[model samples]
Target: MVLSMPSPYKHPSTGVYWLKQRVPARLLAVAKGKSVTVTVDGMPCTVKLGDYIKVSLRTKTIAEAKQRANEAEAEFNRIWLSFENGPVKLTLKQITALAGEMYHAISAALEDDPGEAALWAQRRRERAEVGAKLKVSPAAALMIRPPSLEARLGSWVDGALKQHHLTVTPETYQRLLVEFDRAVGDVATLLERRSRGDYSPDAVAQRFPPVEIEQRVAAPKAAKAVGGDDPTTLTGLLAHKQRTQSKKDDTFDKYRGCLKNFIAFVGHEEVGRITKDDVRRWRDALIKRGLAKKTINDQYLTSLKVALNHGVKEFDLPTNVAANIRDERDAPAPTGSKGYSAEQAKTILQATFRGSSKNLEIPYQRALFWVPWICAYTGLRVTEVTQFRGRHLREENGIPYLLITPDDGSTKGKNAWTTGIHAHLIELGLLDMFRAIGDGPAFYTPYPEGTDLKSLSNHRAKSAGDKIADWVTDELGIAAPGDRPSHAWRHAFTTLSRTYKMDKEARDYMLGSRSQTDAREGYGDWSPEVVDAEINKLPRFDVEASDWRPSLELVPPRPLKSDLPPRRPLRVRKLRAKSA
Candidate 1:
């Protein structure tokens, strides 16, 4: 007769249960709040109540938790089993292929596979040797996790207990790997491709965390103060020095670019160790790289100069390294002078008239041409040209004259002076220039408040001036002058004025020169009538004279020599007669 368990219970797998074992005496004898054990007659086994209940509830024999644990156990067991399974009994080709697959799996796990796949190939050879030495099939010699003895004895059990049905085909093995990977955790689609072995180690490494190189090339010894704690980096030092030196930002930027390229070439480590030879070699390379010799040389020189200067001021490196390093004829020389000759000035004026034939608002090209030309002809610097105003044009006793009142901050003194405008400028139809701009003193360009009487020392004005010069040279085939630029016009004016035998006082006044005499308030006392007479003599391009007049009165004529003014008592008198 079969002993049986009578119970109300739940199955772990199905959540339903049926009685299948005996309820031993010990289970019946179980006391309240205490576990008991019972023996089943005929079975000769004592079953504890807790064990019986557990057995009864888990009717299907495996709990869900147990199933998961079993799966994990089976997985680790499988990996170990692979080691034991004495290499699959197969042809050399088959074993060789499987060995390669296993190595790939190992590498994927380790993430350090070499490029040649040599590790996998080696495993295949080792396994083959083991099989030969054993003389039995390599499959038997190879260790393996064995099937259950009871399951092996019963073919039915053998088939039923199999946990996996994976066939080791190359594709199937790869799929098993991908599934195993995914089973652990879902991978990104990109990473999934790598899981499929469709990617290279580089491709995979790129997908995952990359090998970051923490080490970089050392930088040049920086120009920090000799005993400073800041680790010297060339770039940091240069930038610091740039701010410290009050160098123009653009100039600093240029120096920075050259330095960066040079440092990059020599590498950070060798930056401070650089020799003159290294620089020469680098310079040669720049030439070979198609850089103009002058451009390369200029860059090199600027960078070197900045670096040496920084060293002197900050790092206290050996005296200036750039002092003697000079570029030869291969390098372009500095710009000499920039101004238009008389012929070139005329061409520029003509171009201005042409370009401004239609528009009036901008008139930039026209202004560019005419403004500088006026300066050139009048011997005014570009700054003074910008400072000219409507009030400056006045008539003295029927002759057109220009009153040059220097601004409080003008390079010339704040004192005012009067100069005759050449009749030729009036004749040349330039009177309209004065008329177009109001008597209110201001630059042709709209500037912010307080810029009245301001000049062209600014970058924008200089750039515009350069472009105008280039246009005159290129478009009109003008022969431009060297050196002085708008300033040179003053020189020309002084030269021409002297050639024309214009009075020294009149020439100085016309050129806006500072007065030489302390006696005449420095604006030497020239009579308006005489100045007027001098101006009337000048030639012009036929501009009609306007009824403008000077507000200031003329200097009184010197007293006649015989009817001279009374003199004050002299400080030094003949020694008084000692007697009385």
Candidate 2:
């Protein structure tokens, strides 16, 4: 059966109607960082809107809900178009002709009474003033702040939409705004001419070609439209899986967000109605909105495929419509080396020597100072460096190394691995720093052992990574368009390792990377003594920033565990995966 959902969906259970749409990817960063005021439950409140704008229609009646939803969609389309930087698509001839319609109508209607000519003259002056302030064209000023012609424009825009027999494409909408204002001025001039005892066809409007409606093509061979109930829906699937799957909170959050965005993109909850073309078009929309290709592929597209494939298996659907929907990888690849230039690297490490404006806990402040240096020398991933505890920093056979394992928490790889600490790090009082850390986290506050340990470890590691990345970009000014600030050290390490001709397997072990092609590499031990020899091949960084200071005495001593508040008991969650 075809789904009988309201265009603005009326909830089957709660009877509330809603309009949910994803924010365009171009505006996502802005949306995330800015607060917006929205009306809620009859009261106004300021809130940060995320990826999707999910709002109640504020009416349960089907007809009213549908009307309001269309208006909301239209209004948001205009707002989104305003944010876009793409060029206006309509040709000059078509725009002038469209404006010509407005001119003729205004001229004929005002045959008996033309509003004072001075009123429109003042309107023209106001347009010039607004245009100057905004540093925009006169027509753009008209769109931004229409000079007293909004009431007259209401019917004309509606007529255009009806005449086109479709909603305005963003490009058309942008073009129309410019022409709309020009038309207003043109009509005022016609009225002025009529008042002066002269009535003649407008020479400028006469030259315009006929305004034509842009035709939109429909997708070919869309899937069979199907009804939606509870089981086949993404929200339903998420609830059922959460009961069984052992997923991290961050993973769950990511999937949940993807589901909401996918649903909004498709404009429905009926997963069975989803088509390859539907997913393809949605992918194109995301591309238009300027999402990064890797992000679109890895997070949005991958999660959507997972949801649909899961739905087909669990609900016995006909197929995974998006199963073969591939990536949008046609965009030009970014140019430049992934690693920072040597001078850029030196500048980054040097900036770390500059202290923070506000006081931070000793471990955290030092994390800013040392995370980059540790990554530079050890080739440790940012999370791996930030997540370490004093115990993880241990000496084996009088040689110091870092042990990354699931035993400490989660690792990028499932296995336990060790990489040797460089002699340079040891000479800089790394051992003394660990002595001060004393079994607690080196960069973040440590929770009592075994109490939410996994989550705490993950959270702190992510927090520390973000903190360092922000410090590098914001404070140190190491930002380039495509540079990964936190991950740059890893790239720099790889480049240096290549220059030194370090053994491939040894370098891979230091980077916590595994060999997928080689078989013999599986049998080796990268113990401290083994990797330390390879570690020495990489040269020391000779950074001489004026603010540089290397001292373990600067770090505050770790607080006594005895003085800490009483520990909370560990809360265990039971997870059982459903058998295939």
Candidate 3:
């Protein structure tokens, strides 16, 4: 059998094949040569409106080029037909693709022309309207739709059942079904809107709030009434809070501890029976225990007040007994003017490079050596530095940056930002360590694998920070009485940046501390080059010791397998008798 091949002429200069076709009459004047550009041309309105599509063949081989050209031509013809048919009615799939293309085009244009901002906003509004009309979710309208409601719900149910070995009664099962039905109803509503040409998922969601299924159990015959002496205890309020509010395990645990302590002090009386005098006594007792004023207010009193306030609002208690009790204690004095001094920073860096006196493991040593430098340069919180993964190192416009994000774990205030890596850090071989780790976390080893608990990572990172702090304070003797070694570097960065007179916005951008008060900051127009320049302005720490720099020759630890004696040589039984 004979195979047909595409005939393409090779370009003289580039030695690349070129597929030539006749130019359409409408685009003849615009065409530079005899061959037409393989793009939309017959649709004058599309071309005039700058909405025509152009796809690069992206192949040097004639066969591939020709195949791509044919595909492009088919797509162009489809678009041309749509134009000829008057106002085009697009499919959900086509609309999704167009929305993505439009978004990219608008984004590219916005870089060169700030005036495109208004146009981008207008396009977004139009897309949202169209999405609503099409009954698509906001995510679907944006072209990255999630799984179907039924599929997602089924997977979630199966996973929950398998993982927890959950066994539900008929009432509980019905409640679960009700919740699932609400989710299905949301998706159905969006689909219905698409049929009716109401595409704004946000508008639909706003108009119809999500349904919450309440699971109620019949009260026992001997159960106490609201008017009873033990109406709603602190324990009951805590339980109610857990049911209604979403919180991290660590946060809930802290709240529980504080409430438990308060309950112990005041006795587990009904919330209404608790008085301001009781709250005062608890506060005085905490003060007597030598707790810091801030700790007393934040960890103890604040927690108790929150539960009491919830009781007041939810259960119709007489009043929030702890509401009026305020911590009037004076704020603590500054620890050596907030940040570490230059000499102290150098000493800390040297000690970290020297490793812990307690003979810590290599991973812990690396954490001590690198985390402070990162915090010093980036002004990131200690926990943020601890959560650094190899993949977080990203580049834009030839400038490398650390992508500090909450996706790995909790960030302070849940703010996500990027910090330009200083040249000095690279000189100290931080990138080498990053490359060595390669997609795993950089500092803390034994990262919480296959877990969604942010608290685990946070705790591990905090522990690493504490190790560094211990080295600085106990071994180096650099930190002041009130100064924490891990946090001091952040303050040190601020000091250095201020001394160098860096741009305030750039400083804030690097530190992930930008004020949301300015509406214009939402545009996020700060370029990587500008931020990099600001980061470069901060002075590097001066270390006299040559060994202070972290060693670049680092690699991830390999898993240890138990050594077994070589398998005993297997004795082969003679098969000659069988063969004979």
Number of the predicted model whose TM-score against the real structure is largest? 2
Q: Rank the candidate models, highest lDDT first.
A: 2, 3, 1
Instruction: Let me know the TM-score candidate 2 reaches against the reference structure.
Output: 0.57
Worst 10 residues of 2 by lDDT: 571-580
Best by lDDT: 2
For model 3, the stretches where C-alpha displacement exceeds 4 angstroms are 1-231, 246-249, 332-335, 453-458, 516-519, 545-580
Which ranges in model 1 have alpha carbons more than 4 Å from their true place? Answer: 1-274, 278-303, 328-342, 350-366, 378-423, 426-444, 450-459, 479-580
lDDT of each: 0.44, 0.64, 0.57
TM-score of each: 0.35, 0.57, 0.53
User: What is candidate 3's lDDT per residue for 334-377, written digit by digit as tens?
Assistant: 53567877777777776656767677756677888898788878
Q: Look at candidate 3 and give me any clashing residue pairs.
A: 131-199, 132-198, 132-199, 132-200, 133-197, 133-198, 133-199, 134-194, 135-194
* lDDT comparison, 1 vs 2, better candidate: 2
lDDT of 1 by residue, 95-178 (tens): 233333333444456443233334434544554464355455442333221232123222321121122211132322322222
Superposed by TM-score, candidate 3 places the C-alpha of residue 130 at a distance from the truth, in angstroms, of 85
